[model samples]
Target: METTKWLLDPAHSELTFKIKHLMISNVSGAFKNFSAKAETEGMDFSKANINLTAEMNSISTNNEQRDAHLRNSDFFEVEKFPQLKFTSTQIEQTDDESFNLHGNLTMKGITKPVKLTMEFNGIMKDPYGQEKAGFLVSGKINRSDWGINMNVALETGGLMLGEDVRIQCEVQFVRQGINVPVEV
Candidate 1:
């Protein structure tokens, strides 16, 4: 068929990010509650529409104290703004398998443009005969723009946390027959 919804297969998909911690190795984490949707046929991304959301309280670094701090008023203020969201405004084709997705990202009550580089991995049919599509997306965002800067002075050098955040996403979509909801 020529129509399908690229439903985010959360079981296999991931929304991860990394940032500099104390001028040393990067600290990585993923948003466990997030979703994205897009529509694509055999060879075009013209009608692609995608949206993503992350529950601020779901931030986890495998450290309970750190996770709590992230949910506090200093970082995410999870009680005040419980979610971060992104909605695609436009998807432009850059190549046969690549695309530039420009969208509005809302975090901590601020909104800004975040561009995501995307690659169409491929389409396949599962054992149950359900058609599926896969994609890989990555991008970098400066946390300062979204008012997420939290840091402290290091006795030896730079701040505790860096400004730039690297994000990566691996998503798989099953055909709309799975009862996927469309974002208007």
Candidate 2:
């Protein structure tokens, strides 16, 4: 079996998360710098090995003050942990297009097993004749599990930030072999 490698198409890939703020509305954020790669046997992604990493310092919420607070000791502690990572341990096909992706997520020096849903958006050839694949990954995790338990008590009797964080990513990968330059 020939091994197939997939390189992340950074321009079309995004890592974003949302959490309830003020116990009322959701706050969205994204990691501006992140990367993912996968290896499979002849494009069989069912058993592919996937790895992803996001730079802590690249986190943004569209608000500098909030973003800075998230990067500090009250949350991610970017100075101590520069990156968070995820490595797939297993992938179970739930159907022809959906799968259960189980992996170990490491953040803030803590590692935890996480299960995420992945929807394979099929593969196609780009205008440059490069093979490309797309996927949508979604999941939720408790922030406190990784030591990001910062929050302020509201007068209304609820925490300022929600504990559960919803993660969503639209990732595109270009099959290696074609040397065509990807134009975002």
Candidate 3:
């Protein structure tokens, strides 16, 4: 029943995100090189530590020119910072299968409090009897807050690349040891 110390099943996990682009719509993207780590014991999911790292240059939004510009000094400036990291400051349960993931998200030399609205999508076993847990984490961040401001003015109205960015993560993790039954 220990929900603590559960390893992040890298093979089935993902670190994805989306950002507001112009006042018209949003541009979705993700970090190709990223990892999620967590420590859990049992039904008690409190005080667990979680960390996630993303490679700076691996940012993508399906467009080559825009993606290249984002890597430049006006945006992420991948050459200088080189990494986006998040470390848990505090984690507590909101319900049986959900928690409030509070962490310090550091990017481009700016450290800010980010709350990842987390949902524990339950645990299950495969045909091989390996226990697995799934989670969907989401949060919003201001691009200008991290000094990533590079926008253009439209002939009709507002500038390109909106300030608020909505990020979401759909991650799945597999337990490495013991076939323990989850209580909550």
Candidate 4:
């Protein structure tokens, strides 16, 4: 069997997360520098092996000071662990278009199991004659599970940040081959 390689189209992909802040509101952020790649036997991405990486220092929450603190020792510790990575270990097709992606997520020098629910939005040929595929991914993980416990209590009798973080990504992939669809 021949495998096809797919590379992420950074301009068409986004990695974002939301966490509770001040015990009342949610703070959203994104990682500006990230990359992903996948290898599969064909257009059937249900069994694709996916690998992704994001630069910890590229985290942006729209606030310079908060972003800086997130990269500091209390949070991501970018100087010591600069990259967050995920590599798929197993992928199960829950339906024709939906899948459960089981993978190992590494952050701040710790690796943990993670499962992402993904929706495969099908493949298409752009006007430029490029073959592209789209996917919507979502998952949640506890920040403390990765040693990111920056516990700061507020005067209002609650914590400053939430423990669980919601992660979401919209990724578009460009096939390495021509516009022709691969046979599974």
Best by lDDT: 2
**Best TM-score among the predictions, by candidate number:** 2
For candidate 2, lDDT tens digit of each residue in 65-107?
9999999999999999999999999999999999999999999
Task: Please give, for residues 1-184, the per-residue lDDT of candidate 1 as tens digits.
Answer: 4765566777778888899988788998878888777765643555576787888878878888988988997888999999999888998888888989899999999999989898988878776666677888899999989888778999997799989999888888767665434322
Distance from true location, Cα of 120 in model 1, Å: 0.9
lDDT tens digits, residues 72-96, model 3? 9989989999999999999878888
Ranking by TM-score: 2, 4, 1, 3
Q: Give the better candidate number (3 or 4) by TM-score.
A: 4
TM-scores, all candidates, are 0.89, 0.98, 0.86, 0.95
RMSD of 4: 3.6
Worst 10 residues of 4 by lDDT: 175-184
Off by over 4 Å in 2: none
List the candidate 4 regions with Cα displacement exceeding 4 Å: 179-184
- lDDT by residue (73-137, candidate 4, tens digit) is 98999999999999999999999899999999999999999999999999998777778899999
The residue pairs that clash in candidate 4, if any, are none
- The predicted structure with the larger lDDT, 1 or 2, is 2
Residue 160 error, candidate 3, Å: 0.5
Model 4 local distance difference test score:
0.93
- What shift in Å separates residue 90 of candidate 4 from its native position after superposition? 0.5
lDDT, residue 157, model 4: 94
